[model samples]
Target: MRRADRLFQIVQYLRGGRLVTAHMLAERLEVSDRTIYRDIADLQSTGVPIDGEAGVGYILREGFDLPPLMFTRDEIVALVAGARMVRAYGGPAMARAAEEALVKISAVLPDTERARIDRTEIHMPLWVVSEEERRTIDTLERAVEARHVLKIDYRDEAGASSCRDIRPLGLWFWGKVWTVVGWCELRGDFRAFRIDRIASITCDGRVFKHERGKQLADFYRQMERDEAARDWAHRRSQNAP
Candidate 1:
């Protein structure tokens, strides 16, 4: 990294509320302890308030923020790339937020830097979930966050339809799609519902008793194991001589 880029990185790292030691910064930036100390001094000269104690390492002054120019070329490229990727695949709210953030970032930078970013566009393929499914997933997310029970009309893979009152524990994303992991009042068990398969949803306006020790990751793992077992059995039956 160039000296100026490394210096900016030092300031950004400190502004993130980390107690950075000379040795740690040296290893991270692939520089010597002397170089780290010099960069620290340069940042201090540029009005970055950094505090260092004997044993506790170095910290930036509370509320000390990095200047907009701190972003290196590569850092700006990465930010633009990530923002573009999110805008392409994420939901409407996320796409709009990423667009707003990119706009603000460009508005703050110099015209030259802004032109450089504009010239180097990053592109990614967009996800193709239906608008109806996207709206259903959005509604379920709100209900989960608000701790509200949901009354939903859902259909299963076997074409069985059911009306369910569920206390949503969390939303799980699997295979690039969304599902609701919740306690089903009708079945009296925890169930996972594909948001796309939901025919209708009504917020009951009653908060749920959150499940104990239930994590979305754990539920996904269990679902994966079950699917694997089913696939294995099907293969075994097909291969029987």
Candidate 2:
């Protein structure tokens, strides 16, 4: 679990004037007692109203409540517009989660901010992406998260078909299409397959480990280098005259 999430859980466990022990918090959060102690100290330093020490126990003082979320006007507009786009173009589970996020944002915002969300003019046509492609996207997303090796039958733009076993690294959305970028076992290199061009994809029940020069960071670095090379070539061509 993320440290932020663990800290939040620690706070929740100490609520209602309950004296929660460091050991108890550690066990519940699957972390060390030292981590809980550090977290408690950090929370105390941040004026979280946590009372008590490492050995004894800790309690969140009564009347202490988390502050409401605050967002600037531009932040609200961007969030609402992005959520609407995801709801329209993302997978079924993704769409539902985006909808819930929008609802939660609206529920927490002040009345004026909530009104701004409704007034945000950005919208997306729901029919732009087919249901089949959405399902494919969902599958690939799960595979990427799980670090699973996927066996995919893909047809390229020129109608060439090939089956590949790939270590799913990440998904990239290019406005209208979704592409799964992975380290292709067949090609012995990184390859990106469009979701629409994927005829079939299934997990091979094999999880992959991060290897040197094959991870997502490596892919991004490669992309940056390629882009820089293209820019240099463009500049060279323009200066030729």
Candidate 3:
């Protein structure tokens, strides 16, 4: 990876709570410690809020945000690769978001860099599926980002349809599908709706608040427990025969 790209990765890694060492960055970016140090200097010179000590690991300043501009070549590669993966496996909204993000990235890049991004190839096959599920994922993602309420028309595996008003907590991408985990007003409980099974969605134009990460974690744990119980019951029923 280039020095500029390595610097961007370091910034993101630090933002994600990783304690990055010069040696570690060296290994990860296929460069020497000296090169890593130079890259760090470049970042610091360019106004990135990276901090570190002699023996302790480096970190980004608390609440430090990535600049709205500036992306390195390797960083572009990673973004393209990830976006392509999302386009392949994520729901329609995510794929569209990936495309939009790439466009934004290109807009921010310098002319030469923008041309390079356009020419770079990171290929991935997308799912050949109908787009009926697209709008729900799009609205759910907006709700998650903006902390808004969504009116949902959903169906379960049994094909029972129900209308619900929900305060979306977050979105989940698992098992090649998108799920919205939210506080459902109809059920008076936190619920997860499969994006593909959602028949319709409308934003209520009202925002709600909850512990975002904690709520998602709790929902995932409950889902795991429910799945486990079903597996155990299936085994017991099979043995009873």
Candidate 4:
């Protein structure tokens, strides 16, 4: 999370008109208490009207009204439906995190006003992510965050097996499949390996330097090049036939 956003979130937590400790803020934001202390100091420096010491809990001063977040019934329904979709499709960790946010949103709403969210009428199909796939997604996410090199055993559509060392860069979920994009040491270029095709993956405990051509921006460029090449090839094949 960006520092500015984290600082705003701390204000929201304090707006409950209750004493919130720096440790509690740190836990909620997934940052160190020292970092929270620094953020609080930064907010106070800007005259945010937060009250308390580092050890004691802090509360927002009275009469500091944030413009109310006025949401209609339709908007609340959308938020509820979106949260349900995230819970159903996003990974387990993300699902729980999204639910926590929904709970926070519900906390301030009245019972009648919150009923639209409760009865959204949107139904999710009975589908679940398998253990293997879930683990692969989680592992790839961690690898990307840590910039760890991963050793993976992968099988292609033709059932040919190959081992690769990939500098984990990004992971994308496309409803049904998870794709892990990375710089392949063996290929000497960028590659997108399907999570399901990966028989095994292990973090090699080797962190990679931030190389220019291996960044996410470079990967996007490679994707554009691949799309253009496919279009040219398809046009040529049509002309030939």
Candidate 5:
């Protein structure tokens, strides 16, 4: 987590006049107690009204609040709708983060905007994504961020099963389906594997560095070229007829 986000979380935990210990904060933020102490000191130095010592618990005094966030109605609707979609279709950790983001956004917004958020009619059905697929997506997402190599047992559309070692590049969501775009060591090219079709996936404890042709940008370029070729072929067929 970024320092700024950690500090914000500290303040959020300290709200409602609740006393939160540095150890507790450390555990929650996955940081050391000393780090939490320093963060608290820094927050206090910034005139954040956080009152507490090293060992004792810290509390945000009553009436303390973050500045109201400004958002137009359309922007608010978009934000709320997107968050709701993620909460329904995203991974477990992502869902929790989305919920917390909604809470934080609501906390900083003016009452009118906050009410608009509640009134936003957009929602997503949670049943569309299976729990297993959600977990796979979360794992693939982490691997993409960390540049980890993964071994996956994948079943293609033709029902052939194969295990491939892949350098995870990125995840693409096609409305109802989720696919991981990766550099396939077996095929020596980019392959998009559907998350639901992956029977098993495990990290190989090895990381990969970005290569010229094996990157996500290269995959996108290849896709564009393929699309253009298809369009050209269709145009030629129409002209021939």
Candidate 6:
């Protein structure tokens, strides 16, 4: 964590109106108690309404609004890398928005920070992902964010085709490919749809509520169980042979 980001997190941690101890803050930020002490003093000197004793804890004064965003060098690097990845995989509209946002971030930052951003060497190559694939990712991202049900014409590896109304939950990138995980109304189960395999997609316009077993956490739990079962089967097969 950068000093600037650490300071911002301190404010956020303190904002919940509790006396958070130095040890707690240091532990959360993966820094030393001495560092937290110094950071607190620096923040107070800058007129931030942070009040506390050394051993007891610190709390932010009520009615104090957070100042503008600040980033340390490492945080800026992370931000830029993330934005670049979005540009690499998130398609044209998203790429344009990310670029514009980076421009705005650069404008607000000091020359030192801007220079750091310019000098940063992190890069992701966009080699084989086409404009159409990126557009599909963009469309799926919009659907997930908006909680829109998607009606998709899909094809599997055997060239079997199916149409399904999918309650979009999340989108994931697997290096060379992109996947959208969702609740498939037809199968009555969660399914992972490769965006590349989706023949066509349209809005279903039905805003169905996410039931208890149909959320992302549920999907993760199911995946874990499947992996565990596969491992168990492999071990049993070895013992049998």
Which candidate should be chosen as best, given TM-score against the real structure? Answer: 2
- Each prediction's TM-score against the native? 0.54, 0.80, 0.50, 0.75, 0.77, 0.68
Q: What is the per-residue lDDT of model 3 for residues 1-241, given as tens digits with 9 covering 90 to 100? A: 5556677777766786567888887787788888778877788888888888535678888887764666787987888888887777666777888889889787767776777776678886655334665555666777788888788788899999999998888877775677778878898778878888888888758877675544666777878999999999999999995
TM-score between model 1 and native: 0.54
Rank the models by lDDT, top first. 5, 2, 6, 4, 1, 3
Pairs of residues at least 3 apart in sequence or in different chains that clash in candidate 2: none
Against the true structure, candidate 2 reaches a TM-score of 0.80
Model 1 residue runs over 4 Å out of place are 1-66, 69-82, 109-122, 125-127, 211-241
- What is candidate 6's lDDT per residue for 1-241, written digit by digit as tens? 6789799888889987889999999999999999999999999999999988899899999999754457898999998998888888787888998998898788768766787778878888886578888888888888887889889999998989999999999988898888899999999999999888999999957676778999999999999999999999999999995
Q: What is the lDDT of residue 206 in candidate 1?
A: 86
User: Relative to the unseen true structure, what is the C-alpha lDDT of residue 213 in candidate 4, on a scale of 0 to 100?
Assistant: 93
Model 2 local distance difference test score: 0.89
Candidate 3 stretches greater than 4 Å from native: 1-76, 87-97, 100-121, 127-129, 211-214, 220-241
State residue 116's C-alpha deviation in candidate 5, in Å: 1.8
Residue 185 of model 5: what lDDT?
99
Query: Would you list the clashing residue pairs of candidate 3?
Result: none
Q: Candidate 5: TM-score?
A: 0.77
| Candidates 1 and 3, the one with greater TM-score | 1
Candidate 2 lDDT tens digits, 104-172: 778768786788888989989999889999888889889888888989999999999999999989888
Worst 10-residue lDDT window, candidate 4: 123-132
Clashes of each: 0, 0, 0, 0, 0, 0
